[model samples]
Target: MKTSLKRFFAGVAAAAMAVGGLALGATSAQAAGPVASTQTGSLTVKAANGTTGHTLKAYLVAAYNSDYQAASDGSLNFDTFKYVVTKDNGTKSNDESAVKAALTDAGVKASASGSASSAAEEGLRQLTGQSAGTPFGYTDGTATASAAERKFADALAKKLTATDSTKWTPSNVQDLTPGDGKFTADLNPEGLYLVVDTYAQKDGSKSTQSVPMLVGTKFANAAITTQPAGVGEVDMKNVTVPVHKEVVTDNTGKAANNTPSYNIGDTVYFHLSTTIPDYSGYAADPTLSDPTGKTIRQLNLDDEFEAGKFTGTKVVSVKDATTAIGDQQGVLENGKDYDVTGEDTDTVTVDLKRLVNGADGAKTGWKTGDVIDVIVSGVLSADATTTDKANTDAADKTGADSNGNSNKVTLNYSNNPKDNSQQNKVPGDTVNVYSFNLNVHKVNQDNNPLGGAEFKIVDKADEATPLQFTVSGSTYTHAKKDTDGAIETLKSGADGSIAVKGLKAGTYVVTETKAPAGFFQGALPSYTVTIAEHYTNDKTNTTRTSTKSGDDWLDTLTYSNTPDNYGLVTKDATSPSTWTVKNVKSITQLPKTGAAGIAFFSVIGVAVVALAALFAVRARKASRLA
Candidate 1:
């Protein structure tokens, strides 16, 4: 009975071993099967306005059991899946937004909350195919997923949504959140399309699409505006041309008669006549106005004309037998003589009537038809006689007569045989009578007078001798000297100088009308000075003790001390010991002299010289005595 029981148990044990081997074989086969790949999708986006394009792809895999997780099993159960969206011209935001929108429109239920791997898987599943269980096999599932993904992509491309496109203004699309599966607004549509990539546990996938957005419209019309034309106006008026006139002389001391010429001493008048145009009235009468506008109607020309004068005269005589007159005499032209009795004709009778007619000297003074009368007079050499015998006898009585005849005749005529030509009258040459005009205008305008500002006459010593300047009128002023020996309108202060403020740049004569008490007015130097710009303190103070007429005037004053002690003295050699005139004079005379040790040393040399001289004298006497 025991042996039988052992056989049965052994058989049972062997059967158990066979069953375990079969189970081990089954597990190995499952591990060795084809790996199941988790699918992923990628998104790509493109921008129109200088932006890049993007693309997205979907990767699908067949479902597998969890036992196929090992490599030997050839099954892949993805713990983490990655979906990459690349932007050509667009940013990651744009790619993400485009992908989310694509999935949402395709009826994909994207979870608002999930891990990156779970979200990626969910998004891929939605893009591939609807969650409906379709029984076709692994290939069928892949085809369905691909078709669905393609449809989703096609829908996204049809809208032409791109970054930087005006039409791509999506609502609630500002920032993209990871794993949220929502659209982002950070899109730029400048260039290229969007690219989407997906990574699965066992495989990778991708998709691409082109974005069409209006980029050229942003800068379609750009140009600058045109400007308007311009015109200019100018004035047309008379431009005055200057006329210059000068006097020229001939060899003879007298002015040449060619022109209405006059010697330097001759009374000559200047007459200017403009053709009155019959419209504009003749210029007001000619008058001489001084620089101060003082007019003189009858100014004596003699005062200014002294150089030209006839110093002396000589007489000449002519005598001949043919002419009844025995002798003829007249004033002789300088350096010239005439022979009356020689072959040149001692007597030639001048036809006055013919001379006047041929000479054309009738016209005179402004009127084209007026006639001029000429007069000639001179000392005669002898008395005249009608009979030729008597004329000859008179010519002989006077030595001025030729042929020793006393009958010499002096001739005078109204009409001479000279002086008629256009060249006779020159501009500025005074005729017997004419009309002219004169006009004078002030160039500088008047300025408002400022009071308290002093006017001074400065000399070379820079002495500020106060003078009064009166604002007589707008343009004129009178600077009169006062009884105090100083001028009025000038301010003299304790500083021993005058201060002229607000005075225009010009020349002024500063005079001292009143010297300080006990000071001799005339004894003080007066200066004739000029107040130059930028020279004085701009106030123009003459700083000398004298009047404007003194010689020791200075244009500028160097106080030597500070302005506070300007007129003060530190020492006094003469009376009134406390800072007296002596001290001021000494300081002014020798600027280097002072109470310092250097001044004391200056006298030491004189003392030493005197002592040496005394010793030399003593030595000389001793030598002589010895």
Candidate 2:
């Protein structure tokens, strides 16, 4: 699709109207009357892709002149291919002066002094690249419309839709249904018709709609040479607006992750994205005072998160990327360009229709294919649960039973170009923020529960500093450093279990700072717990250019104790694996007062008596000499 308004509808209209010999054959001759009822042909708008569930409506823009001659080789030859003003099947009006003037204004050529039929033929010839006094390319059946032909077709379709749209009524509607994987409309008066599709939104709707196309049924029976081919049939190209949800890791909005992990009490950045739909045939509504003919009724992005796991949802920014040539972005204003309802709640809805249609005095000139991004921030709750296994399906919303905290985004946009009131809902892939928990158990050599053990946890990256936590009796909750009411020690309960929750993906060291009263305090048991989640991007290109990529989050757990040899100390088979720490008794208590003590006292008394006698004799000898 072209980014500019002038070339926006060029390819779409050209592809739709450029039959490439895909028109129907007229079996009957033209009737001699103002309206040729015999020239009617059965036209089928076959969805080559076999897509169902769309309403195809055709409006007769003009009536073809009855001047074609059937050739011998099953083809119609015409020196002049022209469409004249006739009563529209919709409004029953024949005032085609406005239509001709619109064609002329769009650079289509028509005769000023010729008959109305001749002037209409000349304009159509210029639009279809068919020249007067030349046979239409039906004999060889290898003719294709050129780029110039397509450009003019787009202009003609747009003008007719904008200037004379009221001419279409209920009589020209066709409910395209399942008929051998194709839809064939009933035989009607053959002429130049504008085809537009509409889909009704329902529960679990896969509403795929078709772009506006122009089909000429007057030249029927030309077999289609495209991939989807049939007699008098044109392929209906359907489009589905896509929506994506990702984790924004940086400010550039280019770095995104589908598989992400975060710690509890940490703020997670979320990004919701989708491109603008093609709005070629949509006309301005006079009721809304809309000047741009590309106004849509609604374009919304509703983001839903696990309410129990996420809190304080904040919309950071909403940007319209690549507003124009050389312009990188156009930041939309809150409550104006887009209104965010249910902000700070579990579900945040961003309404982008105002910016899409330039409603309420907002700036216009935003083109199709523009990327709309809604960036939001939310804090992971301290009560978030750890996932035992990674979620393989990104579309699954069962976060509580399957994986981690899930953030999902759903896009709702106008499905019907003619009627903007109807909308289709498309849910994007869900991205998750994961965290893990570590369970520690204190026990004796017998593997019995031993209580009163205090422990602390520190990240391996910075083992010098212990992670802070808020202690409540025996329970410990993860907290930030210097946080109010944060403590350094987490005491074990009577069950000898200490649960440390909301841990990020990294190696952590859990050491027992205070052992039980009588347990050996020498070399308190310490275990290293590593929680890592690895992701592999399936993209072949290492440079990371496109957004269409996939990855899988491989969650892993590793644990090891400080001492190489420990009695009955092991990890249990459980999610958030439990490490049972064992303690031994101190060898200090022995007999205090017994028979051994009495014997020791007797020996000491005898040695003291001998020493005293020797001292007395030495003192008497010294006195005599003096």
Candidate 3:
């Protein structure tokens, strides 16, 4: 198998005697016997050379003429198939006696019982596998081999059962050679074949086992389809699982998908994806191929989603990334290729499994550059209503909070490091949906803080009753939440500020029911307090900002009280942070102390009596004159 180019060329005439092999330069398809028109592919690792325990090896077996018979439970059984070999002239023979006579008449070594054909015959039987006589027996009533296959199996057993000195002269098969972190093979597609690969830490050890076990079922890596004629094409695209999880929100109804401001019970549309390990040059590693060391068996993905906030069912898809439109294979069924074996309310884990093809008996490996996208249709729980920062650091909770929520997606696999298992994880960005808080500040025209002020908040347009709150330590919680009660009073703190928590976007009204000690009506005027999504130019500036998305919204809602009026304090138009408020000034003044004052006094006189007497005198004189 390790013949050099020179030796291959020099002995072309002699090597042509091989029943399955063709001339070194032969390019055309054979007509007499099934040509090993094989094209090879290598399993490679990305780790650097001389790295510890990162070695690789490959195993190949042909599944020719043997159809994989599947069971009701998705298990495999090969249905009985006749040993029919297609000739170059399109003539096929299934009868063992007829096949022997035909090959003899054609002047060829039809029977593979020859000493030189021993290796091939042995290799073929190993590929067919067993059933009745061994644990991996091929025929189990559901799947059994024909007479020709039995003979083939007997021939292959020679290699496995042959004595140490007579085991066809060697115990090793030439592995794919390494080239720039990759390996290549040109396989002759004579009969259907399977390719399996493994790796180990290649630090010059002639023998070492690859980690996590690479022993796989014979049917697992078989050729997927009937091999195509001409040179086979194998394209491997290099792509990694993108680490930056981008979650753009498309909220419905009043749902909030943005970070730190979400409403409870809202659905968040989240998606995460991952990459398949490149198994390009794995065959060359001795650790994986060494009959004495551990070998790679299968590649699996371990992804667990947070359970606290992401609730309900989920959607997962396997996609081929090489195409622009994202060509997708059929959706995988749960308990088929994956299982949620031990899942609960707070944790869910899906393990991608390795399975065999029921049709071709080909074992499965992930396609290169292929990624899996999981559509997590998660809903925020009632716990989202809390004002506490998100439990982002908690490895247990999966709920969305003020700090946002992220999915800790992880990938667990084997063979890349050869000696032990390895893993790589990518974190999705947090989605934040947050509520608002209000701080009502009371001040005077001079910007002086004044306490002892009382106010009532109501739905301005509807004049609905203000919500009531009961005091508990430093907290004032909502008490009676009806629509027609007396407006609950809110008193300013010593600093003239009243903190209102847990509010949403809408318009509210704050009416001063009682003012500080010396106010005119002992009350200040009412003003509309709009708490919508208005951006803020500066934190200290009371005026709202209206810039763009992502800009600061309304924060502090400051109010000022005076003798007969009350209004909000705003930042100076020229200076963003300078607080300012406007109200009419009141001072002592002499009442119309001029002509208007004198006339008003003359007419008065407790003075309605004087006016009535004058009117009576004038009436008597007028009557006498008449």
Best candidate per TM-score, number? 2
lDDT by residue for model 2 (226-275), tens: 31122245556444666776676754456765456677778888777787
Q: Which candidate ranks first by lDDT, i.e. highest?
A: 2
How would you encode candidate 3's per-residue C-alpha lDDT over 478-573 as one tens digit per residue? 333432331368777666566554444456665767766664441245655554432222222111134222212223223222222332344334
Span of ten consecutive residues with least summed lDDT in model 1: 228-237
lDDT values, one for every candidate:
0.22, 0.58, 0.35
lDDT of 1 at 362: 17
Lowest lDDT sum, 10 consecutive residues, model 2, at 133-142
Against the hidden reference, what TM-scores do the models get? Answer: 0.14, 0.68, 0.39
Instruction: Count clashing pairs, candidate 3.
Output: 67
Off by over 4 Å in 3: 1-111, 116-429, 458-489, 505-507, 529-568, 571-626
Off by over 4 Å in 1: 1-478, 481-611, 622-626
State model 1's lDDT: 0.22
Task: For residues 196-273, write the lDDT of model 1, one tens digit per residue.
Answer: 221121111111111111100010011202100100000100011111111112222122111221111122221111
